[model samples]
Target chain A: MFHNDGFHALDRQECLRLLAKVPVGRVVYTRQALPAVLPVNFSLDTDSSVLLRTPASSDLVRAIDGAVVAFEADDFDAVARSGWSVVVTGRATVVTDPAEHERLSRTGPRSWVVTGEGVFVRIESEMVTGREITVPHSTD
Target chain B: MFHNDGFHALDRQECLRLLAKVPVGRVVYTRQALPAVLPVNFSLDTDSSVLLRTPASSDLVRAIDGAVVAFEADDFDAVARSGWSVVVTGRATVVTDPAEHERLSRTGPRSWVVTGEGVFVRIESEMVTGREITVPHSTD
Candidate 1:
C-alpha cells in the first residue's frame, strides 16, 4: 500500500537493511556549490552509520569532512524491470582517533582505490529513505 | 601511464561513450538546500545531454527544471574488483516540444517509472569526467 506512481516508499529499517547488503554505492557531496556523485565501497556500522575508506590524498577526503553528504545504493534487473533504491543523508567526519581507527579497521569498509594512504570517513545517518518497484507476476 | 592511485581518468569522448551504454543512473538535485540522488533511467542525447523521463508530478520534475544537477552511471564487478564511473554536471530543462520528444523517442532512453504523467527532462551536459580501476594481472 506504499505504492506511489509505480514506486513504493520503504521504511527506515528496510532501507538500512538493503543498504547493508550493497557493497558499492555513490556518495554525493557539494563541490563548489554544485553536487558531484563519487562511486565508492562502504560498510554499514552497527549504529546505522556509514563507513567509507578512501585515499588520504584523494578528492573524496578533501571535499567532505564534517560536511553534509548523501549516499545511495540500488539493485535492479533490466529484463525483469524491478529494483530498490536506498539513500542516506548524513554528515561525514574523518576518523582521527587511533583506537577508533583500529576498531573501525576490524569492522569498517576496506578501501577499493588501492596504492594510496587509506583514510576512514564515517557518515552519521541523519535521514534514510528508499523506494522499490517490482515486476508483476504472470499467471500461468 | 595515466594511472594515479590505481585509477585511470577517462577522457571526455570516452566518458560520453561509456555513459550512453547505461540505462539506469542516479540524478542528484538540490532538495531543501541539500543534495539528493534519485535513481533514474536516462538516455545520452546526440549533443551529450542526459535525458530522463519521470512523472510530471514527481519531485525530479519539480526540483530539476532549470536547476543545475549531477548524473552518474557506472559498472563494476565486485568479485573481479573493477569498474568505472562517469559523472556529468548539467542543467535540467523540461522538454515542451513534442517534435523533439518524438525524435528523442526514436533513440532516447525509455521511461521506467510508469503510471504517471511522462514529462521529459533533458540535462544539458556542461562537464563530464570518469575514472576506472582495473584488476591487477596475476602472475602465477
Candidate 2:
C-alpha cells in the first residue's frame, strides 16, 4: 500500500491493474551525479517483472550494466477528478537467456526501434507503491 | 530530415503529428553513471518541445535535475506493417516561472499527478530524429 501525508493508498493488485493499461514507461538511472530518464515500451513478464525492448547504443543499454533501477508509469483522469499511479523500484538486467527472451516476446510491444542491436531489458520489482486521487465535486 | 542506415527518416513536423497520437512515452535520465527511463503522458508545446506533468519527489524530478534527457514517443500499425517514432534529445529544466508555467499549463496533459511539489518539467529539444519501417510482404 502507498500512503503519503494523508491520501488514499493503492494495493499491489490495483497497482498492476493500472500499469497494464499503459504500454510505455520511464526507466530512471544516474550518470556522473546527473540524472536521465528515457521512455520505452514494456510488458509485465510472468515473473511479474517489467520487460522493455530497445536497440544497442541506447542509453538504457549503457546504464543497465547490472544494477537495480527505478521504473514508473502513470496516467490521470481530470474529467473524473480521479486517477491512479504506480512505481516499481527494482533491479534491471539484460535478459541474456534466449528462452527468457522468447517468453517475453509474447506480450511485449509489437515494434522495435527499427534500429539494429535490439535487445530486451527486465526489472524485477523490489518495492511497488501506488496512490489514487479523487476530487468528488470536480466530477460534476 | 533524419535518415540513417537506409531507413526512412521523419522530419520535425511529422514527428509532432505522430507524437500527438500516443499517450505514452519514456523519459530517460542518468544518475551516477547509470541510465533510467520512465513512461509519461506528454503534450507537444507550440515550439514542439516536450511537456509532461509529474508530482514532486518523483524519481523523475529527483533524477532529471538539469541534465541531458531523451524523450521518445511512437505509434505502430501492425496490419499496415508500418510505424513511426520520434526521439527528442535535449536539456530539461523545471518550469518554475509562473508565466511560463501558465503557458505550458494550457498545452500540458489534462490530468496532473496530485502529489506534492508537482511541477512541469519541460524538455527543450536540441535535436529531433525519427524513423519508420514498412515490412516487406512475407507471403513470398
Candidate 3:
C-alpha cells in the first residue's frame, strides 16, 4: 500500500525478509520513564522472534526482560534517495531454560562485542511493520 | 567511560556533535501503548533540539507531539567492526506559532519525501547519551 507521503507499506513477510538481510539493529526500551535505544547485532529464531545475545548481567537484560520493546533495522542509499525500515514490537524475555539456551548458543546470532556468559533474549514478533521510500522515476 | 562489553560511553557534547553529522535517524514513540519506530531525516536546531519536518497530518506528528520520544542515529562499518550511536530522549512539540513556523520553514530540515503543508516538530534534548565501539588493536 502506498501512502500519500510517498511511503509504501510493506507486508509482514516482506518485513521479515528485509530484517534477515541486516545483522544489526537498534533495540528501543523504556528507561527512567523515557525511551532508550541501543544498537545490537541480532538474528531471527525459528519462530521468527527477534533474538539477541548479551552479557547475562548487562543493563539491557535488566531493563527489557518481561517488558515491551521495539527493534528496528533499515538500510538507505543517500545517493539514490531511497530506503526501507522494519520495526518489530513485542514483549521481550530472557531465555532461561538451559537446553534452549545451549541450542541458541550454537545457532543464534554471534555477539558483535566480546562478552562472558551471555544470555539469550527474545522479542516476540507480535507486531511487525515496515515502509519503503522509493524514488519516483521521471518520464521526460 | 568504557563498558566491559567494549562500548565506550560518549558525553553530551560529543553526542550532539555526532547527531549533527547524520541526516537520518529513527524516532521511537509510544503508539497504542506499544512502541513504534520510524526512520526520519532531521536537523539540529540552534538549541540542540532535534528538528523534524513532516506532513502536518502525519501519524508521527500526532503520536509524538507533547510526548517523550527517542531519536537515534548511528554510523557503522561491519568490516571495520567499529561505529558510534547517539540517542536523544526528550519531549516533542509541533511548532504552532506562525512566526516560529515561518522561521523554521526557512532554516529547518528539508523533508525527505514530498509533502504538502509541512510542519516542524522540535524534540528538546533533555537527555543525550551515546556510545562508540572501536576495533581494539592487537599487541602481538
Return the top candidate by lDDT: 3
Deviating ranges (above 4 Å) for candidate 3: A135-140, B135-140
TM-score against truth, every candidate: 0.91, 0.60, 0.93
Ranked by TM-score, top first:
3, 1, 2
Local accuracy of candidate 1 as per-residue lDDT tens digits, B1-140? 22556688898999999988877888988888887888887888889899887667777778889999999999988767789999888898998898997786566666765543477888888998898986472221
lDDT tens digits by residue: candidate 2, B20-100 = 777767676664544545556678787878888776555677778687888877665435555676788888888889988
For model 2, what is the alpha-carbon lDDT of residue B24? 65
Relative to the true structure, how large is the alpha-carbon lDDT of every model? Answer: 0.82, 0.66, 0.86
- Top candidate when judged by DockQ against the true structure: 1
- Which ranges in model 1 have alpha carbons more than 4 Å from their true place? A1-3, A135-140, B1-3, B135-140
lDDT by residue for model 3 (A34-114), tens:
777889889999999999988888888889999999999999875566899999999999999999998998899777775
Error of 1 at B81 (Å): 1.0
Model 1, residue A36: what's the lDDT? 86
Error of 3 at A22 (Å): 1.0
Grade the docking of candidate 2: incorrect
lDDT by residue for model 1 (A1-140), tens: 22556778889999999998888988899988888888888899889998898767777778899889998999987666689999899999999999988888787887765544487899888999899985462221
Q: Candidates 1 and 3: which is better by lDDT?
A: 3
Q: Enumerate residue pairs that collide in model 1.
A: none
